[model samples]
Target chain A: MKKALSVIMVVVVMFLASFTVVRSASAEEVKITGVITKIEMAADKKSAIAVLKDNKSGESVTITITDDLTLDKFKDHRIVDGDEIRTKFEKEGDKNISKMFKKTAGC
Target chain B: MSGKIITIMLGCALLTTTVQAKEHPGKEQILKDGYQGPKTCEVCHPGKAKEFLGTVHWKHASKADHVDNLNHKEEHGMKNRIYTMCNGNDIVNNLKEIPPNAAGKTKFSGCNTCHPGDHTIDVGSTGPEAEQSIDCLICHSTKYDFRKRKIVKDDKGNVVMTQDRSTEAAANIGRPSIKNCMVCHEAAGGGALVKRGFSMTKEADVHVSKGIICVDCHQAKNHKIPTGRDPNNWASDGIYMTCVGECHSEKPHKDAGINKHTAKIACQTCHIPRTGGAFSKDFTKWEKMSNGFYEPSTLKREVNETAPVYAWYNLTVSNTPHFIGPKGSRTDGKSKIYPFKLFQGKAYYNKKDGQLLSMDFAPPMATGDTLAGVASAAKILGIKDYEPVPGWQTIYFGSNHQVAPKGKALGCANCHSVNGVLNLKELGYSAKEVEKLTTPEIYFEKLLKLQQENE
Candidate 1:
């Protein structure tokens, strides 16, 4: 009976810890503007990554995009290499995630 | 005390320069570590200076002159280059009017690249002393080591004039050596395979191995490299020109029968047969670096090699045989048969408008942002809707540079056999012609053996 009770308590504590991780991973948005140097699809098929180089600084950063609703649409115009783009993304834990991408190239 | 000392010091410096140039007259100057301006060398070599300035190299400073006698494709190439530097309306319009090359006008007279002038300075406007303009050591000095700095101008800073030669430049000036020519010629148009399909820098270039230098055949006159096409192509006529006739009799072949083909074929056709021994590679994806340079996305150089395509050439005017155009092209009864190299590359172009989108698409040889280049091109062309039609493009250019020894020339099977590099049918040969070309020759002895067996 004691072992069974300890098991239940441990399960409850594990469930509580997962919520704590979610709560602490407060999603914050960051906007970056640069040229899309390259785009790569995820090997596990869950997301895509776009590498952008800051034109002014020559520095680069990669953003992981997982929004299923926007993935195909995002690729149509904004994801092509050399497209000068402005993107709004969020960082939850370690991943730089993208929510919006705009190709601001002149028509 | 201060003014007088400054004046005296300046006088001594001028005296030192004059003494140094006089000491090495007809040789390279011993500058700080760079070439002294061409003016300094002309003090000793006025004739050479006058001659070199007349060459096409100096005229490139003006875009119009570059395409003056070139074919349609070359004119297109110049349009592409201007697209790279044009950003605004005034600039585009100004560039569209290909102006006359006021030799002493542009900031960097094309001559500055090889002659030793500060590319950063607008010597045309700055009116810097003539002594500050020309550096003759670059082409004449065997030990000359000079690199031109990029034209750098920032929003906040006023443009800076390119400084003079390195104070520590060692000097050994003399007539141009092969090494001196290679400094610029090797990288002409960009890399080893640019401009012409091959370069003299390669060890495989037969003439380079034969102890031949650029001047051997070029034989400069008023700095104009003679084309064997000159009406007065007299080899012994004080013009250091060379043609196959120089070494070969009317028939260069050991077998006179084989030499008959010379009338319809260029010597390079059989001799070169291949390049990089016939191979090349180009990685497709590349990224633009922060400093406005392009690099392969995967950080690897692409390698792709293929067989050469053949063509007809007439040397007097154009290197490319305008008559035939391509390997599969038929001669329009204008050009004689010539050997050529067909180089291929992948890039984007606007299919709708038959123009090469120089700014928007990465050229086959470019490593920078293709889209950015295209966009800029679109801006200049004033196109509202621009899209890319990505594909590989090929050009038939001269194959005269990289030559193999006679022994390595292609055997008959390389072209005449069924399994050959070229498809005669594609080249517009009839079925009968193809069959006849593919048939193996039977010597008289072999024919006699077959007759005996039948008997």
Candidate 2:
């Protein structure tokens, strides 16, 4: 009975450990500051995808912004092309999914 | 009192002082320079003078024909509307008749309140100075100063504006600058902001900082600036202006939706965005009195957006500069979407029938009495039972100039959101008619989400 209980405890501990690994993978892994190059809205006009030129590498990365965030920004602060923005995002396969959006102080 | 003109004066004064400090040759050298007149200009550049004489600038100063322009009023039957402007003794000898209060108290004039006898190149002359001919330096001078000194009373109460053509003539002659054009054009309706709407304020010239000038797109050939405008909102197939598409070959946006949207919108519609920031300096409010005219009530330097004001436009209106208004619609193959300002006027209706007449003519600042101008217009148009409709002359004006840079352009929500700037019903679109228009691929991700949720 004790042997069986130890195995069950081990299995429970592994399941909890897997959740942390998954959370770590999805947490903000990339930090980049760049000027916005372009923004395109979905056909439903619900969300938008923005392309930003990475200030350090001169490479461009795409970030997905949800519609709620877009509406919030549109109502008050507008993020336009040529505006410098710093974003922390998670790498979701081939895509860079935005976790936070902040308009930075540079060009 | 002269709202837009004051702004023009203020703007020009600042700009002139800056350019002058850097470029002014010196008072002594200017006095020595021999810029006798247009005849002097004609000596070497006769071709230019001949071409210029045929243009509107030459005719803008001449008398009688100026009054005769109001002959349309007589043709329409309002003879009382025929009045003179600037016939003061302070004016030149050739005016043919003196004014009601010649060179005395402030008097009534036609459009000549600000369009007075050639403040541009006449130097200070109250009449056509130099030869009874055109002034070349006003347009051709690189360092032209068009500041007309106020005709103030001397110790002896005399009125004078130097009448010194030599001072302006001797400045420096070259291609005209944006400064030369904006001197008058900037203050069209006595203020920058309806009889004077649809203007490019000094703050709103997008290309000026980039070294672009007026004549670049509004190129002159034979002294005629071919603005390619067509009044009465005709098809835009043949008429052309360089504001967009022509000057910029490709569609400006990266998205296809915006590109497709351009078919029904003008570039200024998006570029100009909203009005009445630094671009608009005054709010003109006229109250309709029992006398069948509008009288000035609340006038303030409020740059906030005035809800309903259309631009006076095209060659059809004498006061406006040359411009092409939006001329096409989606039904027409020639439609290129253009944006416009929605202008409001005091409506005129029949007192008996209570039917609407026209609010075609709104008296500008120079017209002294707003009600009198409206009465004259009503009478001229043969509306005997006409009455003023308070606060209901909503009209549309095509947006021009005042183009904002890309960074400052309107956001998509300005026109695309649930409660956007435009009304879908007014535009002939039902809610369902404008539903999602994407291809099947747009639903691919959403479908996956649905599947995941079901799991």
Candidate 3:
């Protein structure tokens, strides 16, 4: 019984350690500061696409946001066009999925 | 001692302003405590009020650059100029004076509903009060509710436009978006999707589909937005918008024949194929309704994906006595074939002077008394001995928006056949030229040869 309990404890620790590694990998998310040119809300209201003109390069970066927190900000007009934004997104497939979206004008 | 006192006063004023600016709370504080109006914004964006006050949006009039219809020195914009849509006389006649009530509210109706101000001022007026009269949040605040922009009567029985001055709206302030501009522009004929069918919707415009907004092209410089001129539109800042030089190349088409056609055809002539709304005012005739109020008896004409009437336009308007149309012909080298939406209607005119009378029909629509509205308009206009007579009027609006995709452009057979849309003879083409252009076989042979050469 003691040997069996020792094996189970080691297995649980290994699983938690792997989870921590996966969480840290998300730090590879790219950051961009730009002025939002357009924000198109999805018909379902579950997602939105924001086209931002990069402040440095002037190229437009399209980011798809599915997070409810950011979607509520758009719906409530806390975030809007011509606003300077600091965003962090991860490129998944052909889409850039937003992890963080915020206004440079404080909260 | 007086000189020392003056210097001390100036120092205190400067110190006070600096202290206020430094102590100004951030957005978080504004959201929690609620918005405090323009004074709170001025603490950060100084001099913006004065700058905005000088714009045409505030003055409702500006320097005329290309108005050929009226005398430039005498008549300018909304003050003196008239339109087929509504003469705008109601707002002009009822302009509230400067220094509004303690609440900064004024009589708002007609044009004042769209005009941005708490009270009206003189043409060249200035000062702190004038700056305060300017409504910055109307354009800047994303949370600004346009539906709340209603024309209602005050407790004193004076009609006033209600404004959305909610603190919730103030909490979300930013630069004006297309949504702000459309609040007035899209509802020009007093309803949604009515007059001025703007190409801002995804279904109506390719640019919008590609995520293009109005400011991307019509970039407002110092609050002066660049606008294309039209007949009855006199206000101008001398700036113009072009597609080729600004966004597209002069020769955008790959086909040599198609590229050559650009010499005599405007881009909009082919690009914008159709324009109008379900409730677009095609022809309006004010008639007495069963309810006794004078309302428009309209013959609703919708475009509904149809061909637009073609005309040659050289950027000049034919402003004859009681007549207006695009001043261009096929003979003019500088002119190009353009599409226009022809709006026709009946209006009250002076029988003796043969001048079209500007009427404020909004009051009559409610009171059911047509003569009273006319009399009030005439009094404000300083006209003597007016006799109203119904007369026919027409206006040619250029079809400039709702651009179809490039793949849907007019093809060779669309204009080069015998049963083609273009009437060659009516377009000022000579007999021989008409024959040559109408022959589809000859045009196709040439097109085939061009294709073979490319191969």
Candidate 4:
């Protein structure tokens, strides 16, 4: 009986430890990269749109920004019709993910 | 001796009489006859007389009785005063004689100098031509020499003044000159004293400098003058929007292009309200449709809600005296940090829940007050109750901070895509079918291209 109880205790401890490790690993941040494909300006010239793409997947997405971002950010980024890009994403919640560019280069 | 003396006297008398008749042929006669008036000549030149009456010159100094025919009321200090007549007697009395007004104040000298036409006829007076009612020979025939003050026949067999005739000289000598209209209508304050409600400013002389003539837009017919003021006073029986006139037809917008269809919409429909005059910020009446239609749903309600309250360390301060909940930090509290407990409504530590809550209620800080104070004061004021629910507490500090739905904040992947490409399907675009039109990718490209070209 004592031997069996010890084994069960060890298994339960490992299960909880593994659960913590899994949760922490899942919370790791991600990075993403792509070429700019579009831009939109607000009527008041305050906000603007910048659409970027994942070169590998050919997937495109749009992002809004204040006047902070400039045209130089996308210059010489090797962005074209079918260039490849890598991105990293961090899950914000069940429905949203915050992404940032890891690196961008010619494919 | 008697025969010789009588013969000499008869010859001298005949010579003197002939010279006197030539020098002042009809000066006294004309002054006494008071210009046979335009009516008598109208019998011979009916069409010309009719056209002359329609000109702005004829309406310059009409009788007050004739001017008052329109439904215009003087604004500011000029109460009950009509603008169409000059403030003199000869013209006013002449106008009165034809129209007959009980409250006739006889004064018409100024305006009459230009509007030289007779709407009425005295039985003994000659018609329009005899009264010099802008006779056709004056303009078409170019017969009257304005400088020489004598009749001259033109090459076309018509009577007219030479082109070199000064407008002032013509007007002073009883002829139509363009300067007559400028004397008042120009920015120099000769035209009608523009009162309130008109879009023009006191210093605006755009109408004059643009070479827009009074007669170009204000056509006259019969004895009636068509003014921008009212249709009843207009010579033509048609509806005309003030914006439809020639010079200002498509102004303000160089390319947007305004037309009759657009003018039908009130000027204020698209233009944000301005203050002062009809275009001023205080002018709200223009929001009404020109056709007298009202849509309650589209009307923007004036923001009159009470300002929000603020609480710190269990002490509350509000614009209104009513307290809605526990106060913030009191004046004597040491920390000045009040423990906020949201009751009645659910409070969430996560921003998503708070955003959801904000969508239904007032924004957390839109009232320019702290949310804790507002919630507490609302409870005290019986506006709402503060009931604490099971949730984590998130502290936010900022002026005018807006809490948006969780998935829709600025830095989300769905918002800022990798390479400026937009996934329309992620932005609730599919439900609205916005994807079928131009996708965000196309829209952004077009905008960039247009911006480059414009630059």
True contacts kept of each: 0.05, 0.00, 0.03, 0.00
Candidate 1 predicts chain B with a TM-score of: 0.62
Candidate 4 residue-wise lDDT, B1-455, digit = tens: 13443454455445434442342333344344433333433444466564554333443322222122233231111111111111111222221111112232211112222222323322113444424534332332112332332223456544332222222222222222233332223211111221111212112222322333344344444534454322112122222334334323344332343323143222222221111111011110112221121101111111111111122322222111111232222234331221121111122121322211111011111121224423433343344424322232121110111112222222212222433223334322453554343445534654476579989
Candidate 1, chain A: TM-score against the reference: 0.61
DockQ of structure 1: 0.03
Q: After TM-score superposition, what is the CA distance of residue B100 in candidate 2 from its true location, in Å?
A: 8.8
Candidate 3 stretches greater than 4 Å from native:
A1-107, B1-36, B90-109, B119-126, B146-162, B165-167, B277-294, B303-306, B442-455
Off by over 4 Å in 4: A1-107, B1-47, B50-178, B184-210, B219-226, B229-455
Quote the positional error of residue B177 for candidate 4 in Å.
Answer: 6.2
Docking class of 4: incorrect
Task: Give one digit per residue, the lDDT tens place, for model 2 in B33-52.
Answer: 56665655555556565555
Interface DockQ of each model: 0.03, 0.01, 0.02, 0.01
Clash count of each predicted structure: 32, 19, 0, 77
User: Under the 3 Å rule for N, CA and C atoms, how many clashes does model 4 have?
Assistant: 77
Give chain A TM for each model in order.
Answer: 0.61, 0.69, 0.73, 0.39
Best candidate, TM-score-wise? 3
Clashing pairs in 3: none
Sorted by TM-score (best first), the order is 3, 1, 2, 4
User: Which 10 successive residues of model 2 chain B have the least lDDT summed?
Assistant: B81-90
